[model samples]
Target: MENASPPSILIVGLDRYGMRACVRLGLEITVVCGGRSWDDGQVAVSPEVRVLLVDDHTNPEAVLMALDRAGLTDRAFDAVYTTDENALVMVGILARHLGLPAVPPEVAVRFRDKAVQKREIRAAGLPTAGVRVVDDVHDVTGITELGFERAVLKPIAGAATRRTSVVTSVAELRACSAAYRAEGTAQRTFVLEEFINGEEWFADGVLFDGELLFCSLSRYGDPCLTAVDTARPLHYRLFDPVTEAWAYDRALPLVTAALEALGHRDGTFHMELFHDPATGALTFGECGARRGGGLTQELVHTKFNVDLAECAILVALGRRPQLDIKLRPEAVGGSHLLAGPGLLYDCPSATDVLALPGVEFVRMEWPVGGRTPQGGGTAQRVGQFMVVADSGERLQERFTAVWDWFDARVKVVPDGLKTRELRELQHVLRPEARFGDALWQ
Candidate 1:
């Protein structure tokens, strides 16, 4: 048979660092974007990357159809990289069907579905926060009977904290259920768990046939999902790895246990965990077999010289990636999602900020006249700024200066506001915690 066209990597999402990582790896890439930025064919990037404009409303089957039309599904590509936690299963199944490896399709659902993952992790005697899945609104009452002070209500298989809520009272729990029902969501899977209040950390690592190849811990002063306000255009400083430990001793064991329990034989593992400072309690939150969102992969690369997207691609292609994790002391990196009024306005001095010593990238999502809705998804970003510094404190200083500068520079000119009340509610509900200040000046 004639030799197939040069091996290509098909990346299914265009959110954060995945596309860049694939490109940096020098892999022939075809990016399938379901968002307008990808659909309008105005994505400003290298020409080597082929863009497949797909609609946001396109179903999973439709995505596969697009791939087939591109002749990619006919064994033209060597591997596929898919983001979006909930799409893990479908992407894996599709990739496998096309005769390619996809980070072990058997455990794809475990990453997105909390109930299934919790059960399997518990079965393996791994330390995991307690979870109760509710099939109906009435299940909230039973969940309350478990005697937990607070319960986290989240969709079983979803991302970006779409319906994730922390309920302290039975009323709030019932309200969460009502809200879910009001949306008419067919899959009413809800995970009610004991809230783990502590220092939050994220562990992203690669696994080769059940063996850990690389792992690093990302420390957060607050729970990541709770750190942002969806009621307003919100932005926050990214976590710096300077204070974080490269050797996640506690996490290493827990990860191994979780993987063994979930039967995840291959692929990258993105895990969120909580460590109680008072008691040194370590608990598993969730794990995904795919790359994480929030531009985390890029943060890791800039801080530690590790590329998770590249790792995912290499694993998918069955090629062992080089392992040279260069650790640097006092090195820091982070990104800020610029959120504000739904409508975009004149953004200030981004060029000047980009010129800063440690600054790496400045990306604005919405155009000067684009509308930015109050949201927690990737679309909510008005802009994003990334920077690196000598320490976490320096990083935060630069981040805050630039953020305040951006906020002052940008304002919605015409006000037909939609999320005004929601913004006020968030200020009331949101607590004041100094994120990224632990290692600050």
Candidate 2:
């Protein structure tokens, strides 16, 4: 007897990690990237894998034509998956067009639209923040009618906190809206939701057959908005027994309820929620139908031994994912090295970061001389690294020690202070308002 040929998968976007997962599963892969070269030399796949270049990865028609030109239209495919948010709807449409297994296109749209998602959750009787869809900054007046002291303004379909801001006063609201308009994004519908003040956390896991199979809750060291507003280093750790127990008791049920209501029957989900330290109440933030960003998938693997990337592909292929949901004794976390407003002159070597105690891996995105933009958004972060330890306390200790070492070694020369003369100009002016409240205002 001979082995059957591996199932073929068409991944609609450039997800190097997802591609690696397909290769690991021994599946034949066809990657369609959106007008970008696949130069990420991360993982090598079988020679059987194919790459199709397309002008627009988010256009289902364009993708289908490309697939047809690549001789894929006549072939049987097990699944169509995309890690890119913009490509989710495209994947869903492609799945239906190709008769592959996937969540419906409408469901994918629900995942992409924050206003729609909040409405669905509210309709399901699940707890969610009050959200108003505004066409422009001036429309935020409706949010004031909702009688909330503060609100969060963000694009209905945006990610990574891009164009996201917190507005307390009407003036701030208008200013934030003006900035978005200046960037030519004002015409797009945005959501202004009642701000939930509390500790921010996220739950990432796989759902199988309408049941939550595996979920890990992570606590952010600082609020995501704060991290973006201040250029502060971002840190998050997967729960150990104590924190896990707390989340399971307080937050997991809410997350499960929201997913059940959203018709998220199968696939990976990354959900953000808040826990009120004052009242112990849990409120829904937002969620996506994909793995969490940054080192989230890595933390899950390091802590629970579940490879979410691989499981995502398997679930998309209509196979029951085999995951180790049992929590491990060890703890895992990651810290992103955020670059301040400047010309990034130097940073500690990956080798040096890797040599730190309990360090698992280091991924540096900024080469020396790269310009670090003048903002606190996640896009401005220079690099990140993950660490694992035997216990939660040990993990925190290592994070502190490693970051202290990093702060001492990493250097960023202010954007204008490239020479001694420019450096003198800094002292002659009021301190530049590069980030934080000043930038947002």
Candidate 3:
């Protein structure tokens, strides 16, 4: 933890999950906060770790300009990284200009955009949800012929499911146009796709020069795309060794094919997927070519005894990271997003929950004086608490119990000192038939 040999690293998108992973490795990290009030999160950097806060409202060009002014450009940092899927291209362009081997900008674009993912998956003969690119409202009528009861619509350059919607009827066709227009389609791009009902999973791993190094698979307690409400709290249990063994034998190769198809040759990747139990079909959703967001970066290290962020830093610095993960370890862990039935009144007993036995860490997202978001993305997550145990199911129970305790204690308030109770709540809610964007009009 000493700064004597801190590895110099540059991280774009201060809120990206990569920070946690790198922190565990004891690297000297410099982050570009971007100065946007909303996108910025409370990132704890060591005194030895440098930070460069960008202008409150600067574009990509300004980001680079700020780095230069802050004297960071003169520093010998390992590599530049970002968790902003939308900024992959920009990150690449910036890093490459500095002669660093950033994540491929072209690959970054292809992975984050659903439209691009669908076409690439199909061309590679990999299984994936049926997707169609929508240029405008005229394309909305075609959904009626498809007759799919549910479909999902999402922005091409979105993260945290911004402006994502699911529709179940022809009458909801207007949502497509409205969603697209809201995204400014004249310049932005989006997609409509058949909503598949199934168990959702996220596979996290590091790829050094296109070779899979260390990886883990985890199951989502609720389907992110189909949940009754996007803000509902959820957890992910690391796939047991038996289950992961199956995936490594059966699914890993397919994933590699997917990586190769996207033209990604290096860096970390967090891929989201859906697997139908009935049909056993693996549908590739999308991927982020950087370290994953949410609690993944931290949980993986706690459970697997490996430092992902350190490896990323070493890779960025053009060094071979020491790989230290055993496929079989005596640990089970999961994370819970703090979701409220109504507007978040307050997260009480949060400290108590963190004090629970087996609880490892609790990271809260709420601002001391800020009101909670009504719905969508990281906004709804007031906090994320993690638990580790001897088995996956046990870990799930510990984490869920914490969420239950918070649900009962937290309240949403409208006025000073006035408190209101939350609505009916469930430990876990899954969205199945509901489509984010309706396939049939």
Candidate 4:
């Protein structure tokens, strides 16, 4: 008799990255995505890959019903995969309903809600900043009672630092909270946490069967909060495994402890943390049950030669991930391109940027004449690029060179019809003077 067909997999979102994962897994894949058109050329249309269009992929029940209607309910799927943050909780719920291996809905909720995450970490005896969940603007003053002179206020389920702010006084807290509420952009619940003053870093890796398989620690050019506050472009440099012994010695154990506390299992995790230089204390910042954003995955591949997307897909299939955690000699880094508030008339061509020495790739978002949003959060970014070099210094030099070239070459027409030098454009970069704040810097 012919062998039974390979176990079918259901992918909740059909983004380019997810599509690539499906292809890598080489499974009979079914995709449930919102919208009518699949115009993006990233995902190839094939008999092996079926697409089920839905109005909303965030509704788990709707997605499951769509799966049934699409004739995938006759048998159980081997796995369900999704990388879209909006669909993560939905994927977890659907996986539970299907009796598949996935992050538990309760755990997923903690990942989505910062307040819940901090509470869980604290309860697990891990070091986390003091936090309070407030439902109204009036409740924000409680931070002072918690003995915090400065605190961070953000939506419970926000991403990329959207609507996040650092408030040093009761008035700033009240104003920030009130603005969010009045703007109708804030979630029903917001988290207020004592701001940990220190250097910020991120740990990205995969967990297989509750065991940490691979992890890479990266240092950000500036605190992410500062990036949002200053509307500056953000960058991160992956530590050279051979040279950055201190990071591994200091940060990795904390990351492992965090994962253990969070009950992480069978998925990629992106964790952010802070290291206080004065006190030598490592504090948890936040984490997500997915790969790090921007060029993180790419950096992982470039440095460690692992495919996080493929590994995540493998975990979903209940198979062991093929990961080798040896760091390469080269270093990898990337930065976002932010456009000033204006009608974008022109920018350095991706082709030209690609021609720069050590530059690897560039992805542009806004076209000519597109109105650039006032830059602050990650969402306002126009594009981003990644590079690889022999060492961190070389990487920084190349990156700065590319930035200078772009600043001189690109032109933006200001919204008020004013002419401003593109060099005078307020794209965020960490000030060089503050470079000494952290050892890695």
Candidate 1 lDDT, 1-441, residue by residue in tens: 476465688777663456676667677888777765464443465687887767641257767777778776665678877766655777777677777788545678677678888888888877777887777753455655634787777777767666667778878888767766676766576677878787777777888767788776776533555555433322333343344433365567887777778877666777877877777778888888876665577666765778887777777777887877876564454555564555555565557668766678765555666765553543456656666767667766776676666665565544563577545444333436332325536
Q: Which candidate wins on TM-score?
A: 2
Candidate 2: global Cα-lDDT?
0.79
Q: Write the per-residue lDDT of candidate 4 for residues 394-419, one digit (tens) a residue.
A: 88888788777887766666765333
TM-score between model 1 and native: 0.81
Distance from true location, Cα of 166 in model 4, Å: 0.8
Worst 10-residue lDDT window, candidate 3: 421-430
**27-54 per-residue lDDT for model 3 (tens digits):** 6777776666435456655555566666
Tell me how far the alpha carbon of residue 199 in candidate 3 is from the true structure, in angstroms, after superposition: 1.1
Put down candidate 2 lDDT per residue, 1-441, tens digits, no spaces: 378887888888767678888887888888887664345343344566687888888898788889789877788988888778778777888888888888788988889999999999999888788987777653455545534678888888888887788877777877776666676753378777899888998999898778887888888988988987776778888877565687677888899899987888888999999988888898888999988889887788877888888888888988888775656677889988765666677788888899989999888876677687543456567778998888778888888888788887677767554567565544433255332223435
Residue 262's lDDT in candidate 1: 83
Off by over 4 Å in 1: 1-4, 15-28, 35-37, 40-46, 49-51, 55-60, 68-73, 136-147, 180-187, 229-247, 377-379, 413-441
Instruction: Say which prediction, candidate 1 or candidate 2, comes out ahead on TM-score.
Output: 2
Cα misplacement distance, residue 413 of candidate 1 (Å): 4.5
Query: In model 4, which residue pairs have backbone atoms overlapping below 3 Å?
Result: 232-428, 233-428
**lDDT: which candidate is best?**
2
